[model samples]
Target: MAIAWYIMYRKKRFDRSHDTEKVCPRADNHPIRINGSDSSTVLSDSNQSRDSPRTSEWSNMPQWLEGLRRKRVASACGIPKYSYKELQKATWNFTTNIGEGAFGPVYKAQITTGQTVAVKVLATDSKQGALEFLTEVLLLGRLHHRNLVNLMGYCAERGLHMLVYVYMSNGSLASHLYNEKHEPLTWNLRVQIALDVARGLEYLHYGAVPPVVHRDIKSSNILLDHFMKARVADFGISRQEKSALHSSSDIKGTFGYVDPEYISTSIFTKKSDVYSFGVLLFELMSGNNAQKNLMEYVEFVALGVEDNEGWEEIADPRLEGKFDVQQLNFMGGLAYNCVNPVSRKRPSMREIVLALSEIRKPRNSETYRVITEETTFELDLQGTFDSSLTER
Candidate 1:
């Protein structure tokens, strides 16, 4: 029986690889014997040795055997087994839909153990499937940081794939910035959020073993918790670093956030992530969506640098002169560096984190006053505009 099992396993592997017996002579080799007994006899003895009814007794054994084997292997690796019904119950029948993206809809759920989690259920016809689910679980599960979302567990049963992550109560950074109902985030908070996001990206690019590139880094993908702490989420396009300096792939990322260099060359690198990060920083500083006014802002800033006019005039008016000019200028410099048309000119993630961190530290009294005055002037300008213009 053991010999039969060995033969079957070898044949399965060979067939899966499309390798024929004529090309591989070793495929005909018989299973080796153990002690004095034949290998086939040992497998027979072991099959019957179990007290429970033998799996072979079932008529549908062959059809179900592979799935059973896969489940056993998954279990050995500490992956949890969850039924669709269990997930449905935890999600209140999928009633609480909090968010949705390229993968699918995310629901706020409470596990039977009473822990709140965000359940990402893959769409029935999602273009991304088990490969993405496995990547996120394996990558995000092992990563632990205040700035990166935590993966609790996952379910892959009956072709229904889902990822379970810690609940982020405040939704996404994009929502907070663009949603009018939510209170405006202070400029300081926005700076801090940028710093947090930079740190997370730095960790993914340099801190992890083999490192990871978060191919998708945008406001909508950055979630905020109850305290408004930013945590990087969504890993559908993430890829592990290889020994080679260049990675090749077809263009894959959100339109406004995709790296121009990568798009042009079809080669991705850490700088690709930096480019996306720059776009996110621009969004935070300008309070504008990348898809909306970023291109115009980029053109304006380019013209400002060429024409020698200070670029500070383009700062977000909604801030009402409440932000520091030096800080804003520093952030703009970083954003400019990040969005550099030449990918090699972009600052590394480490440099980005360090630069943002420096800005967050308290400045000297003179610098503080300068920032305050600039902020006041902005507020005054906005007030003047509001008074002069009719309501739209």
Candidate 2:
């Protein structure tokens, strides 16, 4: 496909904000959107259907990414259909409520085989509507990966709707970070989780033939299994981004995590996910409630990268000086690239995974300076990124 001049890029944009990937509604279809608020409700990607009608949004200009290729094909996965009565029995008539939101209450229950699962009850009158619900079922039913939450079954019985998922015993990453009851995550654990999320996003953006845009990627959306492995959850607002500029203007996302360019142009691409993930990366490093907005904080750190001033000041105090200086610095640089004001400048999730894989713990304090002092990764960022993207 030939590259069309990007209307969004023509104006030349700077000053970006961090927010989740979201869509504004199109002319014909008005789906109820879920806010990207933080929720520790484990495996609870509720199809919460309260009808909050969003205002009409600007139609994003058709901007074809330069040199970007689109490859996609249709594929289907088999999913079991469960009776509402069976689910009702499993949850004792919605008695074991673990979490609740716009999608309705999520109940922890047991099926006949004595397996525990999370049942997200969807509201029939939800703004998300039937089409979006079916899309979630079809999408989640077929897509499976260790880093992604699995959809076990569904119940479209009577006037009630629900989705069944493998239970996430360990809960969400947010619960571990902000919640004082849980222990603070070690630096190594944080790095590993970041890698897991990067791979998951890579699969969605590149693994899928016609890449699926996880319109919503945030800390709350990342669930941890019993093994403490991170699994990307919540396809409540996900959709496929075909080659052409999308016909609909349906932007959906949480406030703090949304990309600035996405807000300016209303044109979302795979890089939109990259921006949100950048915020997540920053959140992991700072160990703060990033949903409150981290643009200023990220900028503050990015500006300090030259002399390495205030590195400790920005790092999560919870770390207590236990982390490897090299590892922290490397991850911080990667975060800066991901959150680069220009979406095109952000490193691809594939690149993020490779970078993390290459960054290992330093041998000892004797070799720490040599390992951490090298700006090899920074050089690569400059070498690989489009120079124009770095220009204001």
Query: 1-392, model 1: which lDDT tens digit per residue?
Result: 99999999999987754432222112113111113121111121211222322221123323232332355333212335466788899998999898788899999999989989999999988876665666675456455566889787777677677888889999999998899998888999998899888877766665554456888899999999989989999987687554213555657788889888888887778888988998998888777899886857766765654222344665777788888776776677667767778876566676566556667777652221111111211112111111112111
Q: For model 2, how does the per-residue alpha-carbon lDDT over 102-167 read when each residue is reduced to its tens digit?
A: 566789999999999999888655666555555676556545556788888877657666889999
Off by more than 4 A, model 2: 1-77, 124-127, 308-310, 361-392
lDDT of each: 0.66, 0.65
Prediction 1 TM-score vs. true: 0.73
lDDT of 1: 0.66
